[model samples]
Target: MVTLKLLLAISTIKQWHTLQIDINNAFLNGDLNEEVYMSLPKGLTVSLSSCADPPLVCKLHKSIYGLKQSSRQWYTTLSDALLSAGFKQSQADYTLFTKGQDDQFIALLVYVDDIIIAGPNLKLLHQLQHSLHARFKLKALGTLKYFLGFEIARSERGLFISQRQYTINLLEDTGYLGSKPAKTPMDPKLKLDNIQGEPLADPSQYRRLIGRLLYLTLSRPDITYSVHTLSQFMSAPRTTHLQAVHHLLRFLKGSPGQGLLYSSTSSLHLRAFSDSDWAACPLTRRSTTGFCVFIGDCLISWRTKKQPTISKSSAEAEYRALAATASELTWLQYILADLHIHSSTPAFIYCDNLSAVHIANNPTFHERTKHIELDCHFIRDKIKAGSIRLIPVRSSLQLADAFTKALSSTSLNSHISKMTVHDIHRPS
Candidate 1:
């Protein structure tokens, strides 16, 4: 998903033509190396069978849909074809293939059989499409508008991606289409725990709901934290969890078409915001790490996850968040390099915790920071290598705060607006 968003953002910034392609019978294209036998069909009567011959089995020579190795073999076959066409596979992302550079640059991202081809040159894209068609049947969908349930709207301003239909379907299926609307996905004052209520009678519904909500977060970052919080109780979801899910659905009903906008006027430079909520989890006492990465003004990546280890202090939690943010930025830098977008300036990372900032810049470790010594070294290395610069920000101005914890309606709206989330289907 990060790679997909990055590709779209780059294409938007470059004003390139982004097209989609599908491989017909993609799994059947792979050549099987191992010897495998299959039973003959029940209805087929061979000539030998009429002669009272022994029961016969068919030897498989090619990959098939039900085979476990089909997907891998198909990817191998496709990679070989792309490589033969002078396209270099990205080490940062194996699914991404690039050919040429600058004005002649063309990038192809493959998600199983579906593909997205982006570049400024239409002739080259068409040529590549034709080439792929010769190797394997291709269904070229000109001008990418939808892929993997994401509805994209392209314009001079940029690309607007949403899952309006997806959200509506979820609401309709859950019988929440006409439910009372919610001002926010989760209540700011609410603290959910595992032992809050009796176990649900049927947990599969809750699990399925969480799974769908997880995919919905692809375009709706506003619900990410809430979804992340609810996902933890998938195994033994209770009545209270279901109630919370209902609230989240009501929130979705309010603005089903809300999504992110990748702006064309945005710069190519990178910046990020890192934040953490110390001891946010009442049961585990673990902190939640949140971060958002941007290419100029366009947000390409963000994450909301709980820390693996419990932090003794708020500074340690904040520092851990900073380290995680640095790791994501490093990967984004590599991805940018693969996309031929280079930058010498170090990416700026804003943290509202002053102690965390000092801990990152100051190498000297004290008794309070010894437990997180490794985190300190990791953050300092990025700082010394000029990969990222840590900046102090006020708590009110922290964009990542929304991700780390539930926020008030006003605060959530303010943060979501800054993240470029909008409802395009609403009255203008």
Candidate 2:
């Protein structure tokens, strides 16, 4: 359900008209496989001793909404119906179904029982409704104003997808609704280190805090570094680490309405930025790898993870970052090809390290890079094959740097602004 909702949230930015509909009594339509029985309700069988035998149990002939397998059963019923109607399920994404007749096409995306129908056929969409209503109790919701978490709006200029309500609720839940705002999520001067010291009072509370901050990444990438740093101490959190998490909540208080803004544009370029910190972790010498993927100006995917293997040098750490970026770009290219949206422009991968770029373009097997030769060769191969081109982007221009380490308030603001996340305000 979350996956389907996220797709609609993203496609809204493309200015495509949307329609949301829900199946009434969705679970009751499914056929039951076994003879399931439930105890009678409290009102029923008022006098248990009055009955000759035990009180009769209500036998379930069809699936109900609250059953464990109810959703999956209803999904199967819907899939069979769509398949019989000549719609083909997308191999890449199961929730997506497509039907086309020459120039006319219709795409149906389903979130459990709620669905959004889009294509070039309003007439056919109405026809589809008549047929669907006959099979199951369904209501056609007028032009979507809000679907899932995003509050949607469309005008002559473009479409707007925002989660203003969600953000406000987050602030209230974290007790940041009445707190003073911090200029930045974290202070650069404060270096977080795990000394040989005692852990916090309650480890579970620290974990709960980290979990919420992770979800905030949906709209606030600025807090990505602070959250990433605090996650390392989940098993045994210290007082200092908990303090850092609290500071981030204060930051969230300031920008409760922020969310990613995907402007309507027509460019098919796959660009990415790769960055890594060299031996930054105090406990372990492992560096963090971070990258962000963009489709034209749309921010689609980003990741921040600790390197799997320890690198002997900074060059090796940077090389691992490139390979991670390549994997993401490859998946993205495949997804585009499936959608018939091929990029005419070549994809560019921006890396901060000069040695990594040289290792990608150069064939020399230096002894220093021998240990990670196989990993280093992927970039060299991709560069030679023209799948990706490595360009030198100045360190200051690197957005992924925000994910690698804590930065000064000025640098934090700069990178956060570059992300282009807008404040999701209510309609005036």
User: Which of the numbered candidates is closest to the native, going by highest TM-score?
Assistant: 1
Write one digit per residue (lDDT tens) for candidate 1, span 1-428: 99999889888988989999988763364433434435566676677746676566564556778888888888888899899989999998999999899879999999999999999998989988998888787789888999999999987789999999999999999999998899999999888989889999999999999999999998888999999999999988999999999999999999999988999998888899999999989889999999998888888899999999999999899999999999999898888888888998999999999999998898776788877757546888999888899999999999999899999899999998998888989998
lDDT of 2 by residue, 1-428 (tens): 32333344345544445577887754465433434445565566555687777646564556787889888877888899999999988776788777875335666888887788865456777777788888887889967776666676665434555566776786787777899988888887777777644688778888987886777675567777788888888888888888888788888777776766666552457788999999888778898999887776666677788997788889889889998898778767765554445666667899989988888778777777777848547777777778889999999999889888888889877886776556646243
Model 2 segments beyond 4 Å from truth? 1-15, 24-75, 101-103, 120-132, 155-157, 193-198, 363-366, 373-381, 424-428
In model 1, the number of clashes is: 0
Give candidate 2's error at residue 428 in angstroms: 14
- For each candidate, what TM-score against the reference? 0.94, 0.81
**Stretches of candidate 1 exceeding 4 Å from the true structure:** 30-58, 373-376
Error of 1 at 110 (Å): 0.6
